[model samples]
Target: MSRKSETSGDRRPAQADALTLTGRQAARVAKRRRVMMLGLRGIPNVQGGVEKHVEMLSSRLTGHGWEVEVVGRRRYLPVSGPHLWNGVRVSPLWAPRMMALEAIIHTFLGICFAAMRRPDVLHIHAVGPALLVPLARLMRLNVVVTHHGYDYDRQKWGAFAKKMLRTGERMGMRLAHGRIAISREIAETMGERYRVPVAFVPNGVAVSHCDVETGVLGEFGLTRRRYILLAARLVPEKRQIDLIKAYAKLGNTGFNLVLAGGAEFESAYEDEVRALASRVPGVVLTGFQTGDRLAELFANAALFVLPSSHEGMPIALLEAMAHGLPVLASDIVANRQLDLPAGDYFPLGDIDALASAISEKTATSLDEQEVLAQTERVESAYSWSSVALKTLDVYRAVTK
Candidate 1:
């Protein structure tokens, strides 16, 4: 499909022209697997990257004839009724010790549910797999786990909590029938830290399919804006405050800087960003923009920046590239693993370098590195379709 002329400057959907077979005609198509997706969150609405990745993957794999189901905590996804989404079964966790047990009970319920479901393949999305490892083996379930990159590294965990998470994560990775990590960094980390072999499968984005509306920006008097955007959560690891400082250093040069993530669930960190955001001029903190609002924030921005100390192939970065917007990011190992366009990079904590990168982006358009390179390195390597396929391969290996 040829792209029509850009009327409003919004990037349109890329070609999704594929002939697909329906479930009614499932026997006719090549797809032949029943997969149960397990995690703490379910579909239709989810907060994190793992949930979004699984949501999109479930839709794509289902259209291709793979049976899919997602089971998550009832508190996260309401337990009122059983639901179906994009050909995936949605079941709720209902255990007595749930609220008191800090996710232990949720894992217990997940194990019981998985054993009864008897799925041909079970794809676990996080460290929850360790809790279910024994049950899955007992039930003869094919288990595959995907490492979501350093969940244990967050500041929310104290010494004991960190130690527990580390041990559990190691156990989960080791006991899985198969494991997949999103970036070379994660793959290497898992192997080096835990001595576990993990297939590298990075996340992807549908760059062109994004729909952004800056109408909300008008509410903040930032309509038709050309500001830099920082879309990550307000956590220390994400380095959001550093971006705020960079914006402060750049300081209101006809461009408005906007941040559209939530107040941290960790109140102390949230307070730090809030205090930092207050001090930065020409900077608007639109706390926690969701679906359409997030797209709008990305759409109207001149550049997208991720000043994270660490990352595992950020989806927002890919989304920015797909939207054809220039990127300015911290040069972390994970960020370097995926080949992007001629993006500006800054030293991790250097405010001067970050300001320079943002100013350079504001000054001119970034060059597009060769098309074949992007197609091979960006498009082929880290797409939802590719992730779905690699995930299916994991399923096959576990089952066999």
Candidate 2:
């Protein structure tokens, strides 16, 4: 008897079969893929750019079906033990509270934990934590280092610390399986310096939906559209002092100058900022705001200013634009990468220039069209979802 002829029902199309196989392969990779992130303070209400970056990136990575665990410093994390945060696991590890010793010690401990857990990829954030890249490599772990910025350029670190950071940059750039930089300038600099291909995955901002709540306004003695806001950690490189001096130069402009962040560790610099703010009229220091409070500050501000001398792509600047607030940042390489109009930037560390810009910006408000355009621009360009996808590509590349 002749065998039944194969029909469409018996054999699938070649393209269809390939598509099915690809889908299965993707599912298998997602199921088995795991990444452990370290080198940030923690997530969920943590301050600092790196912390916020890790928080947003790790949460979105879970949506791609990759298992994500962030190793957090126990001193900074609000909760104890391992817990799930936004579909990503947070493993709190202990570290000394000292500013200089905390990151390295915490990273060393995290590396040991990573060794035991043996995540498919050990993703380390920032140069300070990147110091342990060699140790992570020694354990035969697949390490991916993200250069947030040149930490050695910051004014806070001492000579030895700066040397260590430089060494970390060297080792992380040369030794890691994959390298990522948060800004084009950083990626280009590291790539040219090390002669390695570095991925440029920028920091992102989430557009806030929170209403302009007046509770936080009243609490901080701020009025809607009547205050200039600077929200960043109390650090030397952030140049809060420059902004404060500039705001002081504005005299009585009928606008309050609000500093909306606090330091991770108590330092003389924090004390100095507080003292300076105390001396200036119409200047308010709101210590370390998160959640709706920060959103309100952004939503209601007349203008936002970032006078930082160093950054890896400032997330606060993006958040300010996302809130449709007119922004004035220092003309630094990192801030310039955002491609804001030349008029929006002032000479770095120039108090007179910053004061003039802030005066001009706050005197007039952004029209409805201007506000919408700014918000749309930020949302389109710097999206956390987009960052997650790009970062996933890097992880996959290194894994392969």
Candidate 3:
């Protein structure tokens, strides 16, 4: 099919013609380019990576003339009903609070809502939710599915859940009208495995001026630039235990280790993380921070470490680099794709190597020139504006 024919009903007119249209006419055009996004917990200070991605991408799509609505689980959302945030409409839908069933149930309900509303496109994020793509297609709704990561590879799921996640990946990649992968590695793997084209639309980072406030530092009893920061949920794949053990290996480093996230659901893993963290001195657990507190944590850390065994273009790592902090990450495919310096990556799940890297990184302060260069590199490559435009192209491709 020709591109113009596929996008005839949804694409905006040429710039010259758009400039000549009346305000009401422009509103009508924007309404025609509607997209409903699902597959995340909630937004507007939600802690998970997918939630942050949807919040950033959906909010920015409004600027480019796409009417955006993010459907999230009612249990996780801060508000009770439909609301407007940053010019995008957010609808909180009903979903059971069970850990295993919440995503698929919420997505099924969101797809049904989309079918009735008949938006120009229904954009689903993550493979777990993408399991319902076939259903959306059965309802004759234009569908776009974004494979955030290989959820089957995450250590949190059981064998049966892992198998189901693999099936979700298969159905989402093969059945959706449009496919997007957040990492180049994921896109390539899906294309090769499913024999389908997948757009590589990476997660983005917004670099903001550093917040010099010390109130949060005081609250946490931390010193500026004297704490090693890891800002991810207390999940098994994130390998918080590895970081804690590595920090214990470094005796008298004078740097506190701060874990700035908590789990959304109750799990034995979270309990284990807390027990292990309490045994080690100089380890602080600040549960699920956001807004200024998270910014403060990012801005004042001595070094940022992401020892995750699984990821889909980690937004926390990107945000840390955007803050000009030196980073150490696991050498997984997703983290390696960031192309950080060779010394910045240690082998995945190697506690000794992670310890050595953390010690070496904290021994010296980052040079002013090096900080500026790192900040510029991340800011240029991972701007949210670029992400929004690329995603809009995907929506246009599948619409009409």
- On lDDT, the stronger of 1 and 2 is 2
Tens-digit lDDT string for candidate 1 (1-400): 2345433345443211112445455445433678888765667556567777788788888876788888766655645467887678787766443322536566667767878878888877766445556667777778887887776676556777667667667767878889888887888878897787899887877644345454777877685547778776676778888888888887668888877777324568788888877877778888766667677777677888888886656887777766667788788776776554445677889998888888888898645553234434555556789888887787778777
lDDT, residue 366, model 1: 45
RMSD of each: 11.3, 6.7, 6.0
- Worst 10-residue lDDT window for candidate 1 reads 12-21
**Alpha-carbon lDDT of model 3:** 0.90
- What do the candidate models score in CA lDDT, each in turn? 0.72, 0.90, 0.90
lDDT of 3 by residue, 1-400 (tens): 5766645676555744665789899777656688899898878888798999998898888888788898888877779899988998889999997889989998999998999989888988999998889999999999999999999999989999998899989999999999999999999999999999999999999754545674888998999899999999989999999999999999878999999999988999999999999999999999998887789889989999999999999999999999999999999999999998899999998999999999899998789999999999999999999999998888878864
Q: Please give the lDDT score for candidate 1.
A: 0.72
TM-scores of the candidates are 0.83, 0.92, 0.92
Structure candidate 3, residue pairs in collision: none
List the candidate 3 regions with Cα displacement exceeding 4 Å.
1-31, 208-214
Instruction: Supply candidate 1's per-residue lDDT for 347.
Output: 81
Clashes of 1: 1
Model 3 worst lDDT window (10 residues): 10-19
lDDT of prediction 2: 0.90
